[model samples]
Target chain A: MNKKRIAIDMDDVMTDAIGRFIELYQQEFQEDLSDLRLPGRNLTNTVPPERLEAIKQYPHQPNFFKDLEPIAGSLEVVEQLHQRYEIFITTAALEFEHSFTPKYNWLKKHLPFITWKNIVFCGDKSIIRADYLLDDLDRNLKTFTGTGLLFTAPHNAHVTGYTRLNNWQEVAAYFLH
Target chain B: MNKKRIAIDMDDVMTDAIGRFIELYQQEFQEDLSDLRLPGRNLTNTVPPERLEAIKQYPHQPNFFKDLEPIAGSLEVVEQLHQRYEIFITTAALEFEHSFTPKYNWLKKHLPFITWKNIVFCGDKSIIRADYLLDDLDRNLKTFTGTGLLFTAPHNAHVTGYTRLNNWQEVAAYFLH
Candidate 1:
């Protein structure tokens, strides 16, 4: 049976979160945090450990969610895929306090087509079952048991192994074919 | 006076070396190294010292160069830029023995408009004095005193600092404007 469930990671996969965060951080702090490279996959390396922990403690930084820019072609791709598959927004950000509500609000505001019931915010996404997990993080792919499609991002595209895609159209082609 | 000389990196900026290497490595060794997570950028972990040394000593493998692909819009961009700038194909692949010859040959074969005389192979690129250096490697960008335009690749696109471009069209637009 072709499992039609599709799970997507939020940060770089759906929304340009890391890019927006770095832009905001630099504007506010006058500090360039773009070169802070983190090991592993995804936006996990955008901020230092201390800062990440601090953000987690107080997740409601004004305009943090508002600042998010959707990845190019994401809304269109999601809309197309949703027709054939059960789409779920499975993000690691769900683990942090006040994570889901703000993200949900952001999505609702930007993409009203995505239903609230379809979103699944959780810290650990590997535990959730799905046919395909489109993620920018390598660690998350390692944890996921399903077919993992690594979204090509500036950070994770160089990573070797796993299926790599330049954009969501490619992802749709891969699964739909 | 702005130096009219333009020095371009060979790897991703000129020829698709990494793409070819990954393709061959997979075809020959059945080793799929598609992950963008190269050692220095991600993980505190290092590739085994022996493996690293082996790669260093491996007589710059030119097998991939035999079928190198030109990055999108590279020829058009170079042609347009050449009208206003003295274009130099500067690369650090000379350390790999005669590997650069094939790369040169491939460029000439594919991009016949680019003259071989304009190409300069050096052991280190940053030391080359030029008005501008278009490179994809961040390390090399740091070493150059000239204005640098980084070619965005799947892996290094996440780099925070420096001017980035997705394709040669973007590069041409930047320099021409």
Candidate 2:
């Protein structure tokens, strides 16, 4: 049987971006983001307008994506998934052009098991062709024609329709079965 | 109705890679390649053993892809197609990791009309899902599930199966009809 091509998101799916971004927000302003993850709407409303502009630039900052720690159990679970599925890291990196090299490097360093050839640095998720897309953003999953598996992230706490894989363990459970 | 997504190759289709590679071959080996473009052959057979090693390094060389001239009439023709169809540039750049920045920069410089969001830097062609694919390599076009249009390059002179597009003008005529 042909292996299912699985397109996995990089930011919140593979890395603890929310956890790190909150840490950064705290360091930059000394104010804890207590309710940004709470279900509502509009990501910009999560922070003050002044800090929102600065926070938007965080993904482009040098070493931001490079130094990020992996989402817990993602390494092992993804490696296992890689063996059975044709896994591709389909990431939206156009907004953060500077994040391209660092994100690529981070993937190379951390997820060494996945083929470098399978990594896709794309601007739009709508162009991705896969059997299943595991992402954290509702914007990405919303228009996807294939199976959309929302890998739970703080930003998408209240999304509907797509099956939610709460974590890497959930991902393994969903696919492995 | 949803517009058909058209996938186009980067090297010989957009930029004059065939001419540039030939020029590089002469400068590096001081000899003309007689018949490397002939049917049923390997690309390495075009040069001597030593130069084959050098040729392998050509794609990774600085400014190799960045300095290439756009194919005659490609910019206008692609722009026309882009308006009617969802055009995505599916390029194989993983083999030449260093070529990523230059290739992306070259696209941005020359094909400013094409959205940055539509550009796809990928290693394999089989991953692309589109209604039509315009590529120069027989290897890539051969495996594509879509309607592959062979964008003529010297290397694929004798391959068969896909419809042949000798130039961008021919590409325009094919889709415009």
Per-candidate Cα lDDT values, in order, are 0.66, 0.80
DockQ of each: 0.01, 0.62
> How displaced is residue B69 in candidate 2, in Å?
1.0
- Full-model lDDT, candidate 2: 0.80
lDDT for B98 in candidate 2 is 68
| TM-scores of the models, in the order given | 0.43, 0.91
Model 1 chain B: ten consecutive residues of lowest lDDT: B39-48
lDDT tens per residue, model 1, A50-141: 66765343335645665478888888878878778877776654234334445766767766766644555444454445778889878888
Please give me the DockQ of candidate 2 compared with the native complex: 0.62
The candidate maximizing TM-score is 2
| Per-residue alpha-carbon lDDT of candidate 2 for residues B5-39, written as tens digits (9 for 90 to 100) | 89998887898776677777778778776455455
Give the least accurate 10-residue stretch of model 1 chain A, judged by summed lDDT. A92-101
Model 2, residue B93: distance off in Å is 1.9
Kept native contacts, as fractions per model, are: 0.00, 0.60
